[model samples]
Target: MTTLLEARGLTADRPGDEGPVRVLDSVDLALESGTLTELVGPSGAGKTTLLLALARLLPDARGSLALDGVPAEEIDIPAWRMRVALLPQRPTMFAGTVAENLRVPWRLGVRSAESPPDDTALREALDRAGLSGVALERGATRLSVGQAARVALLRVLLTRPRVLLLDEPDASLDDASAEQVRRFTAEFVSGGGAAVRVSHARSDDAADRRVRLTGGRLEEVGRA
Candidate 1:
């Protein structure tokens, strides 16, 4: 498989009372096309920090980041984020209907060049996310935690990001809903994209690779 994203010597720091605290230490990772990589670590192990840095959302992070062999600095931040999206642990829903929320990505200047998904496509995606009964006109803010998480995932998918930085997507979901998320992730990678999932459950038997972070450092865990 082709290397879709690569990071070397990645580092990040957060302000502490005494001084800047190291959150990520000289980490290196490679995500390939058509693969899912599971990132496991104890809480506060900097797993989320690494994903933020890779998505260029961490201002205190520094290192070499590349996409498809092109240096990250060479790409615009909005463009880079559009290609490499980070879905936060807590799903966020805007104050609007589901259709409006799903269309939010298209409203952004970064997505101005791309056409938004049609209502039919939106409905189809919702169905795939196990939300067929949820009307597109339903208020997004009224969704339950699990429903919101799936909606958030669907929203990101509609943007067609080349890479997915999933932060505990199944944290609030029930067993069935969590399985739906797993299926979506598997399909995403099989369809030529790549993903890095932060998870604690030992349900990543299908992952192409697994890595664990300890005290801000990373080490390989197992192969497919």
Candidate 2:
């Protein structure tokens, strides 16, 4: 598989009320196209930090990141972000309806170059996420956490990002919804998409590699 994303000496820190504290240290990783990589570790082990770094969303991040063999900095921030979509652990929705939220990608200049997914595609994504009851016209705020997560994921998927950085996407999902997530991720990789999923729990989803962190450092590197 071609390398879609790569990081070397990835490090990050958090600025709290007290001061800046280190959260990640010298993390080296690569994400290959057509594969899923699971980032597994204990809580506060920097899993989310790593994911944000991969998506170039962290202000405290200090490291080298490349996309398709090109330095990420060379790419426009907006374009880079759209290509490497990061789904936060707690996804927020717009004040408008679900359909309105789904239409946001088209409103962005960075993403407008690519045609937005049609209503049929959006509805199919929602259905696959087991959210058929979430009418597009329904207020986004009315969604449950699990439903919101799915909706957020579907929104990202509609953008056709080259890489997906998901933070514990299944943490709030029920068994049925979780199954849908697993299936969608698996199929995504199988169809030449790349993704990094942050999860502490071991799941049945297929991943090409496992990157483990402990105490804010790379601890184990294994294949799945």
- How well does each candidate superpose onto the true structure, as a TM-score? 0.97, 0.92
Best prediction by TM-score: 1
Q: Candidate 2's residue-wise lDDT over 4-56, tens digit each? A: 99999998888768997788888888889998988888888889989888888
RMSD of each: 1.0, 1.8
TM-score of decoy 2: 0.92
The weakest ten consecutive residues by lDDT in model 2 span: 199-208
Instruction: Write out the backbone clash pairs for model 1.
Output: none
Candidate 1 C-alpha lDDT tens digits along 1-224: 99999999998988889998898899999999999999999988888899999999999688899999999989989989999989999999999999999999999888898899999999999998999999999999999999999999999988889999999999888998999999999999999898999997645777999999997799999888
lDDT of 2: 0.84
Model 1 misplaced stretches (Cα beyond 4 Å): none
Number of colliding residue pairs in each model: 0, 0
lDDT of each: 0.92, 0.84
lDDT over C-alpha atoms for residue 99 of model 1: 95
